[model samples]
Target: PDILHQLVKGTFKDHLVEWVGKYLEQVHGKTGTKNILADIDQQIAAAPPFPGLWCFPDGHNFSQWTGDNSKALMKVYLSAIEGHIPDDVEHTFHAFLEFCYIVRQNVIMDQTLAELRDALAQFHQYQEIFRMTGVCFDFSLPHQHSMLHYDLLI
Candidate 1:
């Protein structure tokens, strides 16, 4: 579970950075080139040092179970990209954050399953938007590598 969590977290970070970089390049063109790396750096620097679960000591803290940590992380991403992207694009990011919130929550049983379902649905929607806007990302490395080794298969 810990390894899976780390994998998901790393994928999220990579996808987030790639998505933002591609979006900036597409929308801003040449003038945006110089700031792309800076923007990505800023956003990454602002993000939480660890996945939401690890933010809590010993992975036991549940006081912010309502997804405050996820929301805070989203706020940092939004603030970092302020005045740099379109409103609709920003809203898509908000939806992405909501998906992240669902994934970050530490719950079980029916609620967890339901949240996972919703998160998948939201991800599909966000993915569609990304596709339409030409914001490409390669988020399949983990799956590809996992299939290479029997023991690493998930």
Candidate 2:
């Protein structure tokens, strides 16, 4: 199901990030949103130097987001949003990142497949936060639908 564009890029950037931003604004008014988002940006920008990881000085405020950019952001975003957002919301992103990384593995074992299934389940469960928060009205998106088959495909 075109994991790169559908699962990684679409799910993470188009959906989750956008939903989280809206959720933040919903919970915190305009001013609070700015300060909280700035804190997230600072956390992202301050990510320690790593060989392959790229830094985002402006967090996810960039104009364009590619598959690579989303993948890189997944590496650090969970930590950045840990305390700022609800535990359910944080765990939803956690499950998503876990699912994405597990799917990206070149060689898949049965145990990993089980883990993949569990992560997907957790993601679906916690993702209700978006709907409940009114950040997103529907999650019946093609990319989300595609995720249902990822475990079977592997």
lDDT of 2 by residue, 7-119 (tens): 77889888898888899999998899999999998999999989988899888788888878888888888888879999999989989889988988999999999999999
Query: Each prediction's TM-score against the native?
Result: 0.52, 0.94
Candidate 1 overall lDDT versus native = 0.50
Off by over 4 Å in 2: none
Give the clashing pairs for model 2.
Answer: none
- The ten-residue window of minimal lDDT in model 1 covers 53-62
lDDT of 1 by residue, 11-37 (tens): 334455456667777877867745665
Worst 10 residues of 2 by lDDT: 60-69
Against the true structure, whose TM-score is highest?
2
Candidate 1 residue spans exceeding 4 A from truth: 1-9, 35-75, 87-92, 137-154
Name the top lDDT candidate.
2
